[model samples]
Target: MSSTTRTTCQSECLCDCNRPGAACQDPRFVGGGDGITFYFHGKKGQDFCIVSDSNLRINARFIGKRNQNMKRDFTWVQSLGILFDTHNLFIGAKNTSIWEDSNDRLSLGFNGEPIHLLDGEGTKWESMTSPSVTITRLLDTNSVEVEVEGNFKIKATVVPITEKDSRVHNYGITQEDCFSHLDLSFKFYALSGQVNGVLGQTYASNYVSKVKMGVVMPVLGGEKEFSSSSLFGTDCAVARFSGQFTEGNSLENLEYGNLNCSSGMNGRGVVCKR
Candidate 1:
C-alpha cells in the first residue's frame, strides 16, 4: 500500500500541471491556457486517472537534449495515467511497475508511474550527447505553428529537483510528498530554412499527459536524418511534432498550414487516417 498527494512550496509560483515548480500552489494552475484540474480516487481496480476538470483530455511531450544548455538541458514530461480502465498503473502499479530517476538521468519501466520531467540543473552525466528531447502537444493558445526546417530556437526555463518533506513509509503509512520537489518549463525551437547538414526544431513544453490508447510508439530513433514522427490514430487529436521540413517544406500548404508557433498555436502536418 502506497500513497502520495502534494502542492505547497512557493518560490516562483506557476502551478501548471506539467510539473514546473515554485513548489506548492497546485490549484492546478488555475486558468491560463484553461488546462489544470485533477481528481483521483483509485482502487476501483488499481490506479488510473489523468485529470478531468480543466480538460487535459490526453497529452504528451518529450524531446531530449538537442545540444544541452537550457539550465543543463536534459528535458522531461510524463503526465500519463489514463487507460480508460485496464487497471492503468504507475505510482499506483498493479502488475509490473517501477520507474526511478530521482533527479535527471531518467529511467524507464511502466504500466504505471511515468509522470516526470526534470532539468533542475544538477548536471552530472557530462553529455557527449544525451540531451535531445521531444514529447509534444501542450499549447493552449498564444501562437503556435511548428513544422520547422532550420535556424530556429526557443526556450523558457525553470529547474528544481527533489528534497523530501513529510513521510512515514515502510508500512507505517503517512506519505505526503506528492512530488518531492520539481520544476520544469519548456518551449524550444530551431528550424527556419536553407537546410544544410540536416537541422530542424520544434517547441512545446509546459507538460501534460494521458497517453495510452493503443500503446506502441515509444522507441525513438530511426533512419536518422534527424527523425521523429507521430500523429495519433486521427480524430483531429494531435501529438508528436519535432521536425525538419525542407525540399519545399512539407505540411502541404494553407499558408504553410497556418505556421505561428505561439498565441493559439498552429502546425499542420496531417496524415493519419489509416
Candidate 2:
C-alpha cells in the first residue's frame, strides 16, 4: 500500500530555506527518497527543527545570541537547516560541524563549520550549512551519490558602540561591517560503510583587496568507507539527488525518485545495480 500526506510547519521549522522544498513534492511518497530545506528569521535563542530526509532525521535549530538584558538577540544567530537522507543514509550540520551518519541512529552531532561569514570581520562566527546540495541515485543497485555546493560570504568589518565592556556587548556585530565571501562545493558518494569520495573548495576575498583560493578535492589514495564488508552492502540501499541554495536559504528536494538513472550511475571504479 502507498500513502501521501503533507504537514504545514506549525511554526518555522529548521530545514534552512525560508521556502519549502523536498517533502511537499508529490503523492504517496510515504517517506520515499527526498530531502528537506530550512530557514531562520535571525532570532536569538529560537528553537526550530532543521528539516532533513525524515522528521526523525533533521537537525536542531541554530541558536542566536542573548542580549545584556538576557533577551535572545537575532543579529548574530547561526542560520542552519537543509539536509539529505537517502534510503538509510543521513547528512547534516550539527553545532559547528558537518557530518554523515547512518541507521546506527546517533543523536545527531554537528561537523565542519556551521556558518560562513563575510571573512575579515574581527569577530568570527562558526561555519554554517552549505549554500546548496544535489543528490542522484545510481542505476540498478540501491547505492546513491550526492553533490552539495554553496558559498559563504563573511563580513570583513564590524563596528559596534557600547557603554562598557560586557560579554553581551562584545558579541554585537552588524552587516554594514567589512566583508568577504567564500565560495564552496562538496561532493560525497557512499555505498555501505565504504565511501568512494569527498571534495571541497573554499574561495576567500578579504577587504584588503586580497583574494586567496583553496581547493579540497578527492584524494586518490585512501581507505574506502562503504566496502563490501561494510553494513551498506548487506543492510542498506542507496539513492542520488542534488540542488543549489543561497546563503541564508533553506529548501528540500522531494524528487529523489524523479531522477532517471537508466543509463546507469555515472563514474568509474564505481559499480551500480538496477
TM-score of each: 0.24, 0.21
Q: What is the C-alpha lDDT profile of model 1 across 193-226, one tens digit per residue?
A: 2211100111112323221223222111112222
What is candidate 1's TM-score against the reference?
Answer: 0.24
- Residue ranges of candidate 1 with Cα displaced over 4 Å: 1-121, 126-183, 191-236, 240-242, 245-274
Per-residue alpha-carbon lDDT of candidate 2 for residues 1-274, written as tens digits (9 for 90 to 100): 0111111211211121111121111000011111111111223333233221111112222233445774534232122232333222233222312111221111112333222222221322221343243233221111122333321111111111121212233544333321111111121222112111110101001101111112111111111211112212221121111322222212222123222212211111111111
- Candidate 1 lDDT at 263 equals 22
Using lDDT as the measure, which candidate wins?
2
Clashes of each: 45, 69
RMSD per prediction, one decimal?
17.7, 22.8
